[model samples]
Structure formats: structure tokens, C-alpha cells
Target: MDANTISHILLPIDFSESSLNAFETGVAIAQKNNASVTIIHVQDNTFEYDHTNLHGNHKIEDNFGDVLNALADAAQLKLGKVPRLIMGEGPITASIVNTANKYSCDLIVMGAHGASGYRELFIGTNTYKVIKYASCPVLIIPTKKKFKQFNNVLFPLKPLPGVLKKYDLIRCMTSNNQETSLEILCLSSKINDDDEQLFEYLLDEFKERTEGVPTKVSSQYSFGNNIAEIILKTAEELRSDLLLLTPSIDISNKQFFIGPYTQRILHHSKTPVLVIKRNN
Candidate 1:
């Protein structure tokens, strides 16, 4: 998807500190790109309610609506501008994905952790599901991280066919800001002649595509067997504000799936990681 064409950004809020941070980051990006923000709060519908007591059921439903409205109002107030608020009820991950697709969101910005810590919404369950299933790009912000200038963006590159398509979204991301520099961190376990040749080819293609773009584009190679570790180290060394990753595909099963390395980066990266879904 074209970054310039990002008209809507989806932000799922659980009212946690991390969710709030993600909301702010979403708003920041929205304002910068003149995009609208859609705030959604997914209410889990798994809780059982007694159908025997009609009055009690009505009261519960009313309370749920009231709570949703209050949360929406709070989000709007904090956002400083009116945003489209959606109240979703069902499984959390499914609700988020459905809402995003329903709204035709171009991007999803969410927190990496919720009130229940890493094992909750962002890190363990919902976040992973969204990244794996969502058709659009997902930007995950850590709880402690704040909205900052994207001066440096670290993009981890793999020598796979049609990998250049992943960078198209990056162009959109950095289009408005001329100061944003994209650092391409190429990783390889062995620094052989073939690896160097592949790196050069990828770099050339990148340069060709991003020729007229104002953002400074550069490439670096890291010799490491562990792709995740190399990516994290490079990001930290550069003080990268954003990390871009195209998840590895596992074709071992009947259907392709997100690889474990992507999960590792998502769980460990201190900086916000923009996970671009591969064209499978």
C-alpha cells in the first residue's frame, strides 16, 4: 500500500498505558499525514450473563454501552480532535482485524503490551494475531516509548525475491519528512562472494526505486547467524526510532505462516517495529 494513500489509521485501545502511548503515536502519524484516526475498543463477549433475569441482562447491556461511550469520549478528549470511535464485541483479535478491514484502514498502530503485561494483548496474543493476519501494515509501540521524530529507520533486509516491494511502504512513511534517514541493515551468516553480490543487487534496486526521494538512504552489512539479534543490535546502535521488518514465511505447512524471528523482534525490540505483511 502506498504510504501517501494512508487515509485511515486504526488504533485499538484497552485504556492501558501502552495502549495510550500507541494512540498518541497513531494521532501523531495521522496529523502528520492528514489521515483520520479510528479508535476501537473491543469488549470481550465471552462472559456469560444469565438469560433468566431480563432486568439484570438489560442493566448489564446498558452498562456496557455506557462504558464504551465513556471510553470513546475520553479518547476523543485526549486526542484533541474528534475521531471515529468504534465499539467492538467478540474475540479481541478478530474484533480488531474486522474493524480495521471494515474501516478500510491503511495502517494499524497498537501497543506492544497491555495492562496484563507482555503476555496479554500486544505481545503474546492479539498483537501477534493482527500482525499475522492483518492485510495492512502494523506499527507496534512499546509502553515506555513516546512519539518521537523518525530521524532514523532501521529496515532489516533479507535476500529474498521481490523483497523490494516491502520498501514501498517505507517511502510513504518517510515521504513527508525529509530528515528521515533509512538505514538498510543487511544480515548474513556467512560473508561470501555470493552474499556480497546479493547485497549489492538489493542495494542497487533500493537506490533505483528511491532515487528522487529526499530521505537519505544507506546500507550496512552485519555478519550474524542470528537475524533477530543483529537487527536489534543495529537498531540500538543507530538509536533507531522505527524498525521495519518483513516477516519470514514458513512454507513447511500447507499454508505459509509468520516465522519465529519476526515474533522475537516484536517481543524484544525497544523501538516501534513496522511489520509489513509480505505478498504471499
Candidate 2:
């Protein structure tokens, strides 16, 4: 994210505290980047209606539009910029994606909870859906918290096939000015005993490629600690600005963010998380 360019920003508000946190973060980002925001509210009134009642359904739909308008007006005032509040008759996730594409938003900001089981299974998390479908970057703010300056960033990379290529892109993204110094931390828990030799080569290659970038590449072999736990602990100790990693969507197309480790982190950690999704 450059300091000067903001193109467009999409914010999904559900009136939840998490959503409001995301909205405030979006406002700060947009204000800094000089970008405008679009707020979207989807009305799910049909869930209360008796399917057989046709006349009652029409009234519900009409009232839904009115609710959207009111929410939009209130949001616009809070954002300090008039936002386009869009309403459509459908599921939340689909409507959000459709509205974002319609406006060509460059970034999507939303909140997520540590939901589990049937609730997540049936409703399909709006944040997860938006991340999978949005054409641009998505930033997930966990709760109502102010963003700390991102001085150090933990970027975990496995030698998975295309990992290097994505690492290259991340290096470029983190290479900002000297004031915002970023330390790139990479770790590997598997030990080959001959791992030092392999890492020597990998380290040299990364350094050579990231020359002009103001970043220090640190590498380590995970020592008896869980991968995600190590990451969370490290970030907490360093007070990192954000946790940057790539999520590999599994066969179910669900984001396997370090399996349940990510869920645990989100449930407990205060640090913001930035996930870069890449397709092979």
C-alpha cells in the first residue's frame, strides 16, 4: 500500500463491534491514502418470514431497503465522506462480492469472529468469502483495537513449490522508507541436520534479490515449539505491526491458515493479520 494511491476501498458493515473496528480502520487508511469508501449492508429479513406468506414477504423487502438507506446515511457521516450504501436481495457474502466488483474496489476491509461448527459451516463467513473472491487485497481486523505501527513483520515461508516467488513479492511490498523499518522473519521447524548448508544458500539468495529493500531477513529452525505458537509469541515479543503469511486453501476451498492455530491466534492475539493469497 503506497502512501499516495488509494483508488477505491470497500467496507462491509453489519453493525457488529468487529465490523465497526474494521470500518474505523478503513476510514484511517482511506484518509491517509485519499481514497473513498463504499459501505454495504445486506438485509436478511426473509429468515423470519413464513415462506407461504407472499404479501408479508413484499412488505419485508420494502422495509429492508429503508433500513439500508438509514444505515448508509449514518455510516457516511461517520466516515466523513458520503458512502454509497448498496442493498440487494440475497446472501451477505454474494452481495458483498457483487457490490465490490460493481465499484471496482481496490481493497476490502472487514471483521471476523472465531466462529466454529455449524454456525460457520452453514452461514459461510463473510470475511472468508470476501477474501477468496475479492480481486484486490483484503485486510481483516479482529476487533476494536488501534493499529500499532508495523515495525517488525513475521513472514513464514516453507519451501513449498511457489513459495519463493511469493516471498519476492512480499519483499517488494515491505520495502518502504527507512522510518518504517521491517524485519523479515522466516522459520523452518523440520531439521535435516544438513539444514544449515541449505539455509546458507537460501539466505544468500534472498539477500541478493532483496538488495535495495530496507529489510533484514532472519531465519531459524523451529525448536520444539508449535509453528503457529512460535509465530504468535515472536510477534508479541517484537510487538510486530502485522503477521504476514500465505494461506493455502485446501480441497474444501477453506483457508487453512495454519489449521486451528490461526483460529487460536485470532481468538487471543491483539496483533492484526495480513494474509496474501496466491494461486498456483
Model 2 Cα displacement at 224 (Å)? 5.7
lDDT of 1 by residue, 168-243 (tens): 7665555365567889888777787887898899888877877777767798888767887788888899998889
In model 1, pairs of residues that clash are: none
RMSD of each: 5.8, 7.3
C-alpha RMSD in Å of predicted model 2 compared with the true structure: 7.3
Model 2 bad stretches (over 4 Å): 1-6, 46-83, 114-124, 132-135, 160-178, 193-220, 223-225, 248-268
Candidate 2 lDDT over residue span 1-280, tens digit each: 3422556788886555566677777766665555778877665544432222223335434464564566556656665777776655577777887887888776777776421221422222657667666655666776646542344666655544444554543332232554333444445555655655655666677778667666666665554437667777877877776666565211123543234554455445566666555531
